[model samples]
Each structure stands twice: as structure tokens, then as C-alpha cells.
Target chain A: MNNDHNEFMWLDEHHEVSLDEIIQLSGLTHDELHRLVENGALIPNNPTDDSWRFNSHYLVSILTLSRLKHDFELESDSLALTLVFLERIRTLEVQLQRSQHTNSAPTIDE
Target chain B: MKFKDYYEILGVARTASNDEIKKAYRKLAHQYHPDVSKDPAGEEKFKEVAEAYSTLKDAEKRAAYDQLGKHASGQEFKPPPDWSSQQGFQEYTFDDIDLSDLFAGFAKGKGRTHQSGRDRPIPGQDYELSAQISLEDAFRGTTLDLGFTVPEYDIQGQLKSVPHAFKARIPKGVTNNQKMLLRGKGGKGFHGGHDGNLYLNISFVPHRLFRVIDNDLYIDLPLTPWEATLGTTIKVPTLEGAVNLKIPAGTSSGQKLRIAKRGMPKHNQEFGDLFAVTKIIVPTTLSDQERVLLQQLADASTFNPRHHFE
Candidate 1:
């Protein structure tokens, strides 16, 4: 009956770590966190607040963006475009997951 | 020092109409104006255009210049002895424009003679970018690995943006609004012309400790009431770092301590002095006994701080 808790549970199942714990653990500055959110590489539970709450899944993505900018010398605008394109890839993977769940039948082998 | 073809510089034919010549000159002048054009050779090209127009637009000078023939490529293009004394040519003076070496006759090849072709590259246009450094860095020279993007025309004739990284040495005692000219590192000239220069304007970041005037430095040194009254050798911060400073006894709160030759380095003749103004900080929250001691000290002292205001 309670879909709110169900959604949180679903998010937990999808991501290995919760958002609050990740926000506390992340070492990035407020501006850096906001930059990640603005670039769409990070999505926060509280959009109004400046925080890039990253789990294990988002951690790798943030690292990739950092490496591109600091190491590979990609400009902020170019890195933002790369993040947007990468997010699309992540969305497609999620769509495939949903389609597989819908098509699978219950097994009698259980 | 070969003679430059003024007509070729303006991209006009010798028989160009006066109106056509005027129109071309105007267009070329606007494009090659030093203030407007980013081109490295804009200044030189603009001068060349103006010189061409000055000679060709005149009937007599054009006739005389035409007589020189191919020898005008620089060797035998000397003006007639009485060319300047000629009648009815007051409007066109050689002083306004840079006449050829043969015309001016200063030497065979003297003064600001220009070069042509790939052999003589004009210095490219200097590119400018700004950066900020801390006051400490400005006081004690610092170097930065600055990254800048320069728009360069590649071999394909396309304007491509190239990122250049270079170490820029910032000299010590450089003040705000001061410019450092780095020669031979500007835009590439046409047909392999000489490169241009780079100009760096210094800007100092804010400092928590001190404020700098042109060459002088000012800082507020906090002193206790007793130290101001009794005087002491206290540790003070200078642009060169901290130094032991002697404070005279019976010093007022606004008394200035001068440290000679300790401010900014001498740019022209002599270094400036550093002035440390003493600011006596009184404790707001005092113990009963401590308050009694301060009241006793104030009662005993004959110093009146506001005597000058009256």
C-alpha cells in the first residue's frame, strides 16, 4: 500500500548504497557537486540543495568525468556533453532491464 | 633595402581611377588599422597602403614614379633634386608618409625599412591574456605555467584553435597596471613574417596582512596597551617576511613605525619604505582586577589622544 517506501527499496536494490551515506562520504566541494548535477552526471535526492550524492554506480561516473577534465584536458562544456551522452547509455541499459523483467515467466523448477 | 611597390601593397592597378583608389584605400585602411586588425602585419600593411595612395593619387608624383621603371624595385628610384621644390604640390608632402629609401635619401638603406616575401617575416600580432597572483607572489617573484588558446591559421587555411602552454616568469615588486612585454611570441606573420610579441599585465590578489601602494607598503600592527605605553621590540611582518621591530616608549595607538628600504623594490631609483601603524587593541571583557589596573594606568598617564582634534 505504501509506494513511497517501495520506491526507496527499489532505489536501494538498484544502487548498492543509499544517497545520504554517499553525500556524507563524498569529498567534492559544493560547487563541484552542483557542477556534476548541472551536467546530469549526478542526480540528487534533494534537487534544491547543492550535493552530488554518489553511490558506487555514480562514483565511477564522477571519476570518469574528473579524469576527462583534469587529466585529459577536456573543457567543462565538452565534459558536460559527454556526461549527457553517457546518461543516455545508462537509461538504455535500465530500459533493457525493465523489458527483460516484463518478458520473463515464473519458473516451475523452483 | 629594395623599393616596395605601393600599388601592389594596396592591391590596385597603376591606372586605378581616383575614386577607385580612394575607395580601395579607405577599405584597406579600415581593415589594416592597428587598433582594429588582429593581423600581425596590419600596422605595416596599413602604412604601405597609405603610402601607395599618397603617391599614385597625385598626377605628377605618379608620372615621376612611373619613370623609375623596374629600377624602382629599389636601386635607381631616387627622387629628382628639386622634387620637393616643385610648384603646386604643397598638399602631398613626403613628411606625412614613409617615403622609400631612395626618395628620402637618408642612406642607401636606413631607418625603418620594411621587408617583403617569406624571407622577411613581420613580427606577428601580440596576444594578451590576464592572470591573478597573490600579493606575496607579487612581492617575491613567482612563475606560473600559464595555458592559453591562440587562434592560428593552419596550413589548410582554416582558423584552428591551438592550446599553448608556457612558463611565465613574474618579476618581483611588480605593481598592478604594470605590463611585461615578452618579445617574439605573437601571431605568425604572412608569408613567413616575423612573429609578434606578448604583453602581460600584472594584477595582485588581496592580502590579509598588508596593503601596497605604488612602492610603499602599509600594515596595521596590533599592540597591547602596556606595550604601546612602555615600548618594546616586537615581531612584525614585512613584505620580505617577519622582522624584529623596535617600538619607542610612550607610543600612541596611531603611531607609525617606519622600516626603510623594506617595501617594494626600486623600479626607477630607490626602494620605498614600509609603514607599520600601531593599533592598540583593548580587551572588551576584563576581570575586575584587570579593569582596576587599566583604570590606574589611564589615571596616571598624561596622554590625551583627542587633543589635536580640538
Candidate 2:
């Protein structure tokens, strides 16, 4: 839940970090990031123009891609497609829940 | 069961031309093909695709599969007493799996003899259910006691109460309409089949003061006219509790104050901003002395909100 929102706000209070911090943490090359963007494998958060401000979560994605590239040698498109498949699975799971009713059914006590 | 009707499966009228049938098949094949499509159910659809195409592509096979109609895949398949015994007889074997196996239970032919005493394991039916939660519970990631029922077969061999409870965790910033999966919680599998999955859709009860949109939270902060004209530091309630916010002097109603990273806790532990919109309230009744002071202040200040409209 959101109880941690106030607590987490101070995580990046200094705001002194740079792309170098992302590279150090995620261990992905600048060229690889640019390639992912060029191939449409990644749609930048800002669509109008390309900016290099990556959120911490985006760094995690880069980390995942790095592992995929190292371990499986998957192309950027293939990794992107895999992410799309995972998203689809999440969507189907959600749709199934909407079709099922947990509270609408009457309880025995009721 | 009777093989699926090739025509119906392809959604084409029997009277349609070969070109029409081919077009329909091409479109459907593109959608259900394993190589090109992303449907998880594509494998099951592959069999159907092959069946329809084989039957429709050949003139002789098309005539035969059409004559068989619902019985194209039967077991007790007794051809019209003199079927093969007649003048022209042709038996076409197109599929690796026995066509009769597909039609055994469907048509009046041999009725399900192969399935005799066979305890087939029917995979459990997938089920979905939603849980509506409170904002605080969503924030704190509390467990919800969700209750539901299923039919339980017992020694008596009749439908019985199979009430069950599951404890579900509400993740931080659990948005409304989002789903959480609880595996193997749906209808029980038949004949020792794998149990189905249970999905939990997230929902939230409306809060008295806060309105959530995605990760952002919005709130209306009421301010006194005096506070709007001559601002002061005020205590505002946030999800994390209350914080003192400094209001700028000469602040006007409809001004927005943002408290950064105080909205919702996201997956990466990031938080959005909470925006507060100010609404200046005017006193309906005033004493003579209060009215005289306000009149003096109004005369001194040359501010008119409606000047832009004019």
C-alpha cells in the first residue's frame, strides 16, 4: 500500500546522481541503451524527444536486458517481445479476475 | 465428440465459392498459426485449422467430409448399409489422429465406447474473483480474508457447502482493477488433473478526503479568505500523516501546492506528488466591526478577479 510513500520520498533527496550511477548499478552500456531506443525495442518515457533521464525502475529493466544479453544472447527485439508477452500474461490474468465475482455471491450467513 | 464442423469453424457458408473459402481459411490460419500468432490457445486451434483446410481444399475430400456432416469423425460409423459395397468407394486418410476418435461421442455412430471406464483427467477450470480493499489496507499491504464457495463431492454424493477462505496481500499502491494471482485456487481438477488458478482484481472504496488517479493523489484544501489574502503556514494531512506547508503571501483560490514524492509507493519504491488545490471560503455573516475592517481592506486593495473576463 501507499503507507511507505512518505517514507520513500527521501530516498533520492540529494538528486546528485547521474547516468554514471545508472551504468554502475545496472551495468549496461550507453550504446546498448541507444540501440534499444533506435530499434523501437524501448519507447522512451518522453516520446516527443529522446532524453536520458532514466528512472530507477528503468534501470532494473536495463539490468534484466543485460542478463538476457549475457546469458541467452537474445536480440533487443526478442527481449522486447518477451517483455510484451509477460505484459500480455498480466493483462489476461486481470481480465479473468474481472469475469469472476468474489463478493457478489451471497454468503451462507447472509 | 463429433469433430468440429469445418464450415462452421471457418465461418463460411457451404454455398460460398472456393475463392471465398480459401480467403476465410487464409485469414483464420494467419490468426491461429503457431509461428505468427501470440495466442496461448493457438496449438488447439492448429488441429482445427488443418481439418478445415484439408476438407475444403480437395474436391473429392470436400464432397465426402460434407456428406459425413456431423458424423465425419464417428466410431460405430456404419456407412449407409451399402456404402462401400456400392459402385464407387473411396476412403481418404488425412490425419494422424483417428477421425473416428474425434467424432465418437458426437454423432449417433458408435457412442463413446473408447472412453468406457476411462477416467480422463479434466484440468481444473480457471476462475477469477475480485477483492475490494480500503486505502489504508492498500497502503500498509494488509492481508484480506476473501470468502467464496465451490461444490464439494463427499461420501453422500450430493452438492455440499465447500466454503473456503484465502488470505491475499494488497501490494503497495494497489490500483483499482489491477489483478493479483493466487495459483491453484479455482475449480478442482477432475481425475487428478492440475488445479486451476484464481485471480484477484483490486478495487478500493471511495475515501472521504482523498481521490487517487493512477499513482497521484489529489485533495481539496479549504482556506479562509484571510489566509488566502495574507497567507500563513498551515498543517495539511498527508498519507504519511500531517505536514506543515508554507502558503505564499497574496495566494489566490485555485492555487495548487505540491508535496513531492508523497503520492503512492510504486514498484521501484518511487512515490508521486500529492497536489492540494486551495478553495477560499468567505464568511456568510460578519459583525459591524468586522464588516468595517473588510470594507477598508477592499478599498485599499486594487484586485478584481473578474477583470480578465471583462
Candidate 3:
């Protein structure tokens, strides 16, 4: 079926996900969630606000964390530590892509 | 249905204690988790391990599974006639009932139930997919025919995959791997629950004319020896079209001539600069006339490229 949407928003800096929204998205309990944050998996842009929100990119990270938590019986703190390395690997892959020269230019006929 | 030996799957003894089962499960899970493991069969192996563990980890589910008479691995078997009389399972046709689903029903007794699983509403699942567009399309922000399988809940709360196709207007200035979240366009939520998001990870197809680094574009501009020395204005192809670029006198190979606002669009409606890297090309074969002219120039001109070595 054609489930077309005329408008869409990017999950960039402009779009932020609220704390409640993240908890719902991640399926982590409050205690587990707090441990994850305390272990440095998430940092809110506004920590003072009751409705502190996260950058939307963290949605991918949190979702990945959720899967890791479910698949492995590790504590949230340990999972958050693993998340740090995984995110690094992802960033390194992108950086690696940038460094390589594909040389896809067409040949000029003499 | 074919029977699966949970103990055999985990490589644990049937008489293994809870701690022993937990230890076995952890080792196998670590090795088979799709995210961590590099094995080709990791995902399927993980699912099998997880499924087996889910049933065995709980006291009630394990006991209920033990109620069923054990059979050899992969042996075809049906549930006992009086299984429906047991707790959690109603008197339903056993012809199509999966063993995992049956045990999952038993485990739900003291655990989470799908009906009451949400004290707070859970958002629907978000989908992430990649779309490859041309550099020109990325510069102009084109619409693409995008599609994904939407995970929806049926009337009985069972999950189903509904294939969905739609036109998506990819915004300009989105770099490779930049994620765009289409709000409420992901998997549909369960009864009155919040809708999920659709994440589109943008990637550009390799362009023949341009090499993109961030917002900027790089193009190789091949120049003749005369053009390099005489300083000629040549048309350089850009994403928009061709623009005349000045090749200054004594231009060297690998020197970049920049064109303003001719690259990919960026924040604040500003465009990045396009760089034309100069490459001095010489004729592979020289005719007699060309050879004589070149010989005369070689004899007259005293430009030594190997001056550094000297």
C-alpha cells in the first residue's frame, strides 16, 4: 500500500526527543535508564528541565542499546560502556569512507 | 511440529541448575548476538538461543515444558490431549500451535502479558533504511519512491508485516548517512499507542563528474601543456552546469581552482565551493610536426621539473 507522507522531519539537531519519548522508545525501566545515563550513554541538552530531551541521533544509539540489553544479560552500565565503543566504530567507518579516494572520474577522450 | 531440545541447544545438561543454564545462555548469547558477532548465521543462531533461554530462564515455563514428555531432537510430536486443561492454555486446535508460542503463554502467567504489558504507552517501532541518490539529485533535493515493510498488530495483537510504498521528498543538503526522521511514518502503534518514526539514511550514488567531501565537490580538470602555460579560460562542469574557470599562467598539476557556491547546498541556504583540481596531460603519441615543435620548445625552454633533485 502507498503510505505516503507529504511532510517529514529530519532527526538532526533541530529535532529533539523528550525523556519520556526516549524511555518509551527504548523499553528500558527507569532504574536501568538512569544507570545508562549515569554511565554516559546519554546526555540531555537541558538537564535542568523536568522534560529534559535528547538529540534525535541518540534514538539510534538507545535503540541499539535496547537490543544489546535484551540479547545480553549485562547490566545497563556495562551495556552503556559497550555502546561507547560501538558508536566509535560507526564514526570511524564514516571517517574511513571520507579518507578513501574512489577516483570515479570519467576518462577524457584524447 | 519438530521438537527442539533446549538443553541440547544451550549445550547444557538436562539436569543443569539455574546458574548453569544462565552461564551457558550467556556464553552462547555473547557468541551469537547479531550486533556483536561476525558469524554469518549469528542472527538466526541468536534467535534460537534467545528463544530457548526465554523458556528455560523462568521457573514456571520450564516446569510447564517439562510437563510435556521429552522426545529426541527434531522429532515430530503433538501436545498431550489434556494440555488445554493446563493453566494459561485454552482448549484450542493443536494442529498449528507452535511450541514456543505455547510456552510463551505459560511464561506470561507471572511475567509481562501483551494485553497489560503497557502501563505506559509504548511507541511503535522505528525503521531505518538507506536511499542512494545521484549527486545532482542530492544538490537539488529530489523526491524518491521509497518503501518498507510496516510492522502492524492484527486484531489479536499478533505482529504482521504490511509492505508500504510512498514518495518521500528528500531535503537538500543532507550528507551521506545523515538520518531523516519521518514522524509518525514508521510502524503503526498498538491500540491508541504513539506512532513510531521512519528514519531514512541518505547516501549518494558515485558520481562520474564529482567527488563529494562533505558539502563540497571535487572535479578533475585535465589541461594541456599549452593551456597550463598560456593561462586559458576553460568551461568546467559543475553540479548546476558548466562554468568558466581561469587557468592562470604556470598552473601546476594538483592546483585547485575554486568556484563559489557551485557545490552542494549547506546550512542557512549557503552552498559550498567547488574545487577543480588541475591535471596536466601530455599527448601520448606525437606526430612529426608536433614532435618537431615540442623538440624546438624543449631545446629553447629551460624549465627543469627535476630542479629539486639537482
Candidate 4:
């Protein structure tokens, strides 16, 4: 058994997804991917260079955008904004949940 | 075997145009997409709609399916001898397979005879499953026995869910909300395409004794009223075990005492500090002698806790 195949790596800068790999996995065209970057919906790990790889964290965002475009039949140009907004909404939802948990703690005032 | 009506699932008439069918499928999919919908059954509904659209969209497959004629959904029926399907003599009990698989097999059988089995390399589908672990498990690396179903098109061209079970090793000290990528642990790829990856969104089960903030942990430390005033050393529970923590004099309820490097462990032997918040517990009943001593002290002490109110 290859242990690496079952091993899990933390989502970090080291887990790099190349441009070609993302397009293949996500079924996003080369042009659609470029437009997402142009709209700032998809940001590369290093904006200044590589321009061809993204941090593994963006996989969910990219896949979600592609799914939305395919299902709703929306063009890539129109979906770039929707993707950005959806990402923001998801982030805010997580933040809200964390905050509620923190606030619900028992504060015993002496 | 139960029969499934693809057109009915998509809410389109048998004679509906391709454009109309596409529109219905899009609307249903948009409403039930797991990531988009809040409905608990959205995932299942979306899959059904997608299965229906897969054949309905293809001209040849639709024609093949239309020949089966309309039957009430979920009615027990058997496929005609001619329609036992064209992928060899293998039989399918709908319980083991699905209506979609049968139709998919029809297409695959057609492709085989027409194209001489020229198969395209189809990439395996990726999957995500959320995993919950205890704080103790996070402190010490643990193994997770995960069981999940992966949707795949088998060698026989039957679209089915392959049950996949494996023990995943979760590294120690993984923070909450972190996603772990398991390479080649997802559905097996078709042809020469690479196997899919699995993403495990790791979360810690709530601990009754401790609340985790990032790598650090906060614990409610209950102390006797005298202990709060006179300072004392008490054993507090940590992720490892009980450890002696010092409670300074004049410690008040809600005040946090930091125990350096005693919380969660991190990489390279680094550790997070623990915070023990003080809570004063006063006894309701006292002995006669204790009451007398307390009354005497009450008479002597002039400390006013409400001085700030003035």
C-alpha cells in the first residue's frame, strides 16, 4: 500500500495547484480561468509571478464557480462577480458562527 | 424492480422540447445544488435531477429511453427481454443498481458496438466529507475509520456508488476549520486519468472542560472564596492531565491566569498557553464556630467591593 495515497496534507502554501490542473479538474476553460483572475475572483498564490499556480484553498471556490456557471448557464464574465460575492458570504457565515460560539461562553462576574 | 420516470423527475412532459427540458433541469439543479441550497435533502434531489438530465440531453440516449414508454414512477416492473439492456447478458436487480445505470449502460453498449469500444479517459470525481474529532484526539494523532460512497461508472458502464472505507490518519494538533487533502483517496479514475482526491474538513468536538481558541485553550477554574482571597495551588485538568496551577491572591471571578506553554501542542515542539479563569464559590451553610469567626472578621474588615459605584 502506498501510504502517501492515504496521507492527508494540511491546506497551505505547499499544496500548490497548477493552472493546467485546475482547468482539467474544474472543467473551466483557459479563457474562463483567465477572466476569473482578471476579475480578482481567483487570485494566484503569488500575484507577481508563477501566475500559473494557486493555493489549494482556492479549489472550493473555483469548483463552486464552475458548478454555478454550468448549472445556471451563466457566462464566465457574469459569474466572476457572483463567485466573489459567494466567497464573501461563506466567509462571513463562518465568522458569524465563530462569534456566536465565543459570545455564548459563560461570563461569571465576581 | 421499481421504474423511474426521467421526464417526471425533471418535471417535463414526454414530448417536451430539448430547450424546455434543459430549462427545467437548470431550475431544479439550481434549487437543489448542495452548495447552493439549505434543504437537507438537496443533495439527493440534485443527483436525481442530474441523472435525469444526463440521458434526456443526449439525442440517442433519449430516443432509447423514450422507447421504454411511460410507466408510473416506483411501479414494480421488469425490463422487456429486448431491453434487459445491451451490455452483455448481465442482469440488474434495481435494488443493486439504478434506472440511470441501465440507461447509461445502454449508451455504453451502443458506443462499444458503434465505435469499437473507443473509450475516453474520464477523470475520477472528487469528494468531500466533514470529520469531527475530540480535543484529546487532536492533541494526540488519531486514526479515523471513514466510510463513504463514491459515484463511479464501473467497467460494465453501470453508474453506481462504490462503497469506500479506509482508516485516515489525522495529524496531531490540527486546528478547527482546517481542510486536509487526501491524495488519491477518492473515487478510482477511469481509463488513464488520475484518481480523485478527498478533502476532509476537520473540526474538534466540543470539550466540556475546555474551550479552544486557536491553539490556546481556556478553562473555567472554580475556586473557594477563601482560596480566591488567600492564593493557593490547585490541580487543573489539561489536554494531557491534571497540572498544578497557581491562583494568585486577590484573584476574582472571570480573571484569567495564564499557564505558559501548557495548552495545545504545535509543530517543532511549540505549545500554546492555557488560561484558567477564576470563579469564586461561597459555601451556603457554615458551622456555628465558623459563623462566629466570620462575624468577627466581618466586624474588623472595612474593604468595600462596591467602592467603584460611588
Candidate 5:
């Protein structure tokens, strides 16, 4: 194996995962996934195609929703709403963090 | 391994009913869910609660655990020699629980069952780690060397984490909190199973000169009073290299000058814009000629900056 510190393989957002892979990773059944897609909770990259493809970012959301559904026994509609609320919270948090940093003095830490 | 009291962790009775235990687990899970919780140790607490619930919720596992006797939490104890053979617990998949020190001991050759002619394959556990990168590095893709201590099972079935080092390239246009998955880079599988993936959570280190807002970049460009009033072309540093930026005449302090397509690189080679925010600076110490000229200018010019107030 090349152990060089500088040598690396670049990864990007384009590493699309298939529907079967998402199912395996998230432990969601075909029906559950279809429900999510119907509710606009899970969006495939190409919605028109028979085989669904999703960006890697959806993996985290799918996994989290699966866990929440398992733990809380939440219905599909409730799960969809919860996912949207959670995403909104995350966006607001990021905005708050940016505003905080902007207001402070920029210090260089060596 | 140190013993963990499941009932005590959940603040429930030793003889708590299954329904009661489930209720307690749900309450605690809601309180400490890593994504929603604000507590600093919420993730760790969440994992502990999950482990406790996984064992206690299952009737067989709970019975086996009760057979171990009432040991205090954190009390080190070893299982009986025949414990593995007696338990016959279901093979816990990686998705069920994290391989903590306690679970590592419990998982030792206890759940495997021969089927037809071959052993069943158990997929490895997914691992997560946060990585810090510079803003500049995120703009222009860079490679990083990361050291990880990963768990492996010895011949004796004892779990140990050995030090491993690997390099990964962070692609350009990676935003903060974005995760990159390295497939088959996590825990080793059992019985020729596929390895799990490594999820890297990216966090950008604070940059000295630039503040990244989404894909856009902002930098403070300090200019002299004269430079602000009378525009000049000045060299500005970017991630790629320095480029000359033209400041319009009569440019005021705090005015933002845009340089198109000079910011962070996005997917498909698209670029964000960079904004140079102007800051007017004055010399702290004035020479005799400079002071005489300023005094002359003060008497000569009839410009009032606070005309609105007047």
C-alpha cells in the first residue's frame, strides 16, 4: 500500500447510491421508501426513472428517520413532518453559527 | 470488562415490566438523541442508553443478563466459561448496537449458528469521525493523513483496536457539516462478510483572512484614506494566486467590491464569487511634511463628512 501522507483519492458529492443500496443501509422496506418518496421526505436524483438514485447526503437523513420511526413508532406522515422540522432546525443552527462568527474578531490559531 | 447495570442506567426497577422498560427507553432516547439534544455529551449518553435498551428489551438477553447476578455498575467481572454456549443469543447485527467494550465481550463467539453447510455472514459496524480542514483546502481539494484506532478480534476472541493510518482526499466545494463516506473502511466483517463504511463529518477550521459564507468568500482589504477616495488597482490574494482588483473611484470604506468567479470551486467546475470589503486605514504616526499637508488640506477643503447631522 502507498503510505505517502500527501497521496489521497478525492471524493465528491457525485457518488450516487442506488435504491437497493439505500434500502440495505437504512433497513427500510420498499413500501416504507415509497411512502417517504410520496410524502416528499426522500427525493431521488432522477424521479422519472424506474430505478432511483440518491445523493450521499440522503443516507444520513434516511438512517435517522428509520431510527426515529423504530424508536417512536411514528407513522409515515408524522415522520415526514419530523424530518422537515429537523432539517429546518439544522439550517437555522448553521445560520446562527455564521452570524456568531461574523460578529467576533478573526483570530488566527497556529 | 466492567459491568453496566441496564436498569440503573435507565432509572428503572430491577423487576420493571417490559412495557415500563420500553417507556423508560423511549423517554431517555427522546432526551438524548444526538441530532436533537443540546447536551455536550448527548451522543455518548444516547449510545449508552441504546446499548442498555437493546439488551433489556429482548427477553432472552435480559434473562441471561439476570443470570450474571446483581453486580454494581463499573464492577469488573468475567463471564462463566460456559456462558457463551449457554446464552444462545441471536446474532446481533452492526445496525443493532455499537461495538463498545461491553458489547465486544458479549459478542464473542456466542451468536453464530451453522446453517445448511456454511456460516452466516454478519456485516461490520459503521464508524464515524469528525475531520477538520482549512477553508482554503476545502476551496481547492487537498489530501489529508488521518490516524485511526480500529477494533479487531484476536484469536482468543478478545476485541482490540490497533492503530491504522490512511490518507483521504477531500474534494473541492465541500461545505461545512458535509459528510463523505469511505466505503468498506470501517469495522471488519465476520465470516467473510462485507466491511462497513467510514463516515467523515467535515468541519472547516477558522481561516485567518477569509470568511466562507456558503460558497461565497469574503476578505477584508485594508486601504489607505487616499486609496479609498481615489481608486487604485491592488493585488489581492486568492486560493489559486494573487490577482489585481480594480477599486472604483470615490469608493467608500466598507464598500464591497466583487470579483466574479474567484471564490470557492463548486461541482462541475462552477465557481462562487469573492467579495473584497474595503477598510480605510490611517497612519498612526504622521511625519512633519504629512502633518503640514493635512493641516493645509483641512483649511483648504470644505468637505463635511457629518453633513447629515448638521
Candidate 6:
């Protein structure tokens, strides 16, 4: 029955995560990271910077990709396509939710 | 600990070939993988599938497991006195494997010995949980008190879930369906390993007065027919507070008015716009004097709403 209150940390859309952090956290190799970037599956925070930077969304993407690579034995080439489809599916689902919420409201006479 | 039938868990025959077992595991893993699947119980199911596969995929482990044949699933069973001294059992360890108490108990001492050589530290598994907040909370940013159980090992090397309490901050400008990651706040690490991260899949509770689309907010502004034709200024509700909106004269129902920089906040102090959609409400019951006046106005009016149909 320990009632210790832990410290709070805020992460927003603007959080910039470094590439080394992604590698360490996700257990992905440097070659695999390069392949994902080459295939356009991932985008760095800045294109010209010597060290790569990533946004928070890339954290979720890397986790999903690593699992897919291990479980399905998928290569980065195929992963690129899968990432595209996953993004599309996520966008559509969000759009669907928004429309459903909007439609439930009272309509006006046209 | 209760014995779990690995073959039954993977939906494979006990005599199934390696390829067949692998195929079944792959399909089930895809369906129950916590990263991809939306099922609430997916993580637990995936853990079971993975544990089963880890044992069944290895030839030595499979043969050793088969030696304990025909025990009913979930039946309480203990290994023989000399089980650890068996040929394949001695070399087997739980170094990088996350096993249930049943398997962990059997491999406890052996796992520690095998790990003593390499001393490789394995990070803890990451955890995900969903949180809901009010749209206003998302707008203004707020703190949430969360209570949940996280798994840890006892002094006896037995795994158990311990209750934990923490406060997490929901940052401002977070849209619905956004995810935020809290680093090193998940399950406890082992052997000086780093703790795993916690991912918060955020969702906003639907508001009674407003509807959110992307970062924009929308609301139905009801007005009388005269107000729609002869517009006036009226107070409108925004996330911050109330603001007066000037409706242009001759505004039509279903017309939308945008209030810039008054919607949900975004990065760099940017904001999406709020839209107010007009809805003209008519009185259901009118007095005789009002009905007469309406009739006169309608009769005198030359506007024909159905001119195209005519």
C-alpha cells in the first residue's frame, strides 16, 4: 500500500528525440536504421545536421518496425511499404472518428 | 505453479512439425502483438504465445518439455527432484527470456548461474496504457494521478505485480488520439538495466458543446430566422472563454464562420481555427398576431426558395 507520488514529465509534439536514443531504446542496428531512412520510412528532424534527430512519433514507429522485423523476418524494403499502409490506416481511423463525432451533433436545415 | 500446455496454447498438434508450429506461432503473434493489435488483451496473449514458442522452437527445450507429457493444462505440477540435472535442462537458462512463474521457478538457480558468466543486462519490457482527458485539459494542459500495478521480482525470485502511484502531465496543444512517451517509467529493469518507457495513448472525452476535428473546434450556433437575415453580435463559447462574434447580415443557415487563432493550440504558438456553423431555429407554436405578421411578410416577399424546382 505504498502511496508514493512520482514526478511528472510532459512530452508534447515538439519533443526532439536524438537518433542515438532511438537506437539504444529500440535495439536497432545502424545499418537497419540507414535502410529505413533510405526507404523513406523514417525522417530525421533536420536533413542537414551531422547527427540525426527524430520526433516522438518515430519512437512508436521504431518499436513497431523492430517487432515486425523480428516476428515476421521482414526486410526494410518491405517495411517501407508496411509503414505507408499503417500511416494511411491511422489517418483514416482518426478521420472516421472525427466525422462520427461531428455527425452525432444536431444538423441544420439546408 | 500450474502447468500450461504449450501445444494447446499455440493451437498446434502435439506431434506437429517445426514448420507447422512456426506458422501457427507467426499468425497468432501477428494477431496478438501489442504493438500492432488493438485488442485490450493482446499483450497478455502475445506473452503466452511467445513463451510457448520459445520453448517449442528449441529442439532441446521441446524434448525436455515433452518428457513431462500428458499433464492437463493449468494442473498444479512440480518438476522431479533430479529434473535440473537432466542433460538438456542443465545448460538451459532464462537469461533473456521473460517467462511465467511456472517456468521461472524451474529455471531460477540455473538462470542465475548462466547469467553470472556473461553478466549481460537486459532492459525491462515497455508498457502502454490509455488515458482520457477533457478537451479543456488538453487545451490548457493538466496533471493526472494514475495508479496501476507493475511487475517486479520479490526477494525469493518470484515475480509479482506491485501497485504504484504517479502523476503524469498532459501537455498543452495535444490533439485527440495523440500519443506521448514517458521515458524510463515502465517496468523495473534487471541486473542494473535501464527501466522501460511508458506510452500514453491519449484521447479526449467528447464535449457536449463542441466537436473537435483535427485541431479545429466546431459548434452549432442556433439563431432565429430574423437573426440569420438581420445579423447581430452574439457571445460564442471558445476553449479559453466566451467571445462575441459578429454575424454578417443575410447569413444563411449552414454557413460557417471561422475565428482565427481561437482553436486548439499547436507547436510554436500556432493554432487551428474554430468554426461556428449557423442553424436557424423556428418557433413551433406562434400566437395569432405573430402568425398574421409572418403571413403578411411571406406574402409580400418575392424570394422563391423553390424557384429551381419550379
Give the lDDT of residue B229 in candidate 6. 87
Best by lDDT: 4
lDDT of 5 at B241: 92
lDDT of 5 by residue, B1-310 (tens): 5678889988899999999999999899889988667898988998888888888887877877887777878776666656645765333232212235435445434544334423456677667789999987898788878767666655544456656577877878777667766667777776677776677888889888887776777789899988878888899988789889987777777677778888888665799777787889999999999999989989999989899997
Residue B301, model 1, lDDT: 80
Which residue pairs in candidate 1 collide? B3-B74, B40-B125, B121-B193, B121-B194, B122-B193, B122-B194, B123-B194, B123-B195, B124-B195, B124-B196
Model 3 root mean square deviation, Cα atoms: 6.0
Q: Give me the candidate number with maximum DockQ.
A: 4
Model 2: how far is A94 from its true place, Å? 15
The sequence of per-residue lDDT tens digits that candidate 1 reaches over residues B175-274 is 6445454545555554465555555656667678776665667678799888887888988788667888888877766666778877786434467777
Off by over 4 Å in 3: A1-9, A12-21, A28-55, A101-110, B1-34, B38-123, B146-151, B156-161, B164-167
Clashing pairs in 6: none
Model 1: per-residue lDDT, tens digit, A1-110? 11122111111112343344333223334566567677766676556654323433454344345534532335655755766665676557556644532323221110
* Least accurate 10 contiguous residues by lDDT in model 3 chain B: B105-114
Per-residue CA lDDT of model 6 for B1-72, tens digit only, reads 467899999999999999999999999988998877889999899989988987888786787678766688
- The residue-by-residue lDDT of candidate 2 on A19-53, one tens digit each, is 55445434567666566656665445445653444
Kindly list the per-residue Cα lDDT of model 2 for residues B256-307, writing each as its tens digit: 6777877776656688667676778888999999999999998998878789
Model 4's alpha-carbon lDDT is 0.75
Segments of candidate 5 deviating more than 4 angstroms:
A1-16, A71-73, A90-110, B89-110, B114-118, B147-165, B282-310
Runs in model 1 lying further than 4 Å from the true structure:
A1-110, B1-123, B239-241, B267-271, B298-303, B306-310
Interface C-alpha RMSD after superposing true interface residues, each candidate, one decimal: 36.0, 19.6, 7.8, 5.8, 9.7, 7.1
TM-score of each: 0.43, 0.47, 0.73, 0.81, 0.81, 0.81
Model 3: per-residue Cα lDDT over B217-287, one tens digit each? 88888999999998899998987778888778878787777787888897457998787878999999999
lDDT of 4 by residue, A68-90 (tens): 78767787569789878877886
lDDT tens digits, residue span B1-310, model 4: 5678999999989999999999999899879988789999999999899889988998877876776667899887766667545434244444555676566556444554444655655456678899999999988889999888776666665557679999998877677777777878887776676888887888889899988876778888899988999989999888778888777787878776778777787644688878787778888999999899889989999999999999
Where does candidate 5 clash, by residue pair?
none
**Ranking of all predicted structures according to lDDT, beginning with the best and ending with the worst:** 4, 3, 6, 5, 1, 2
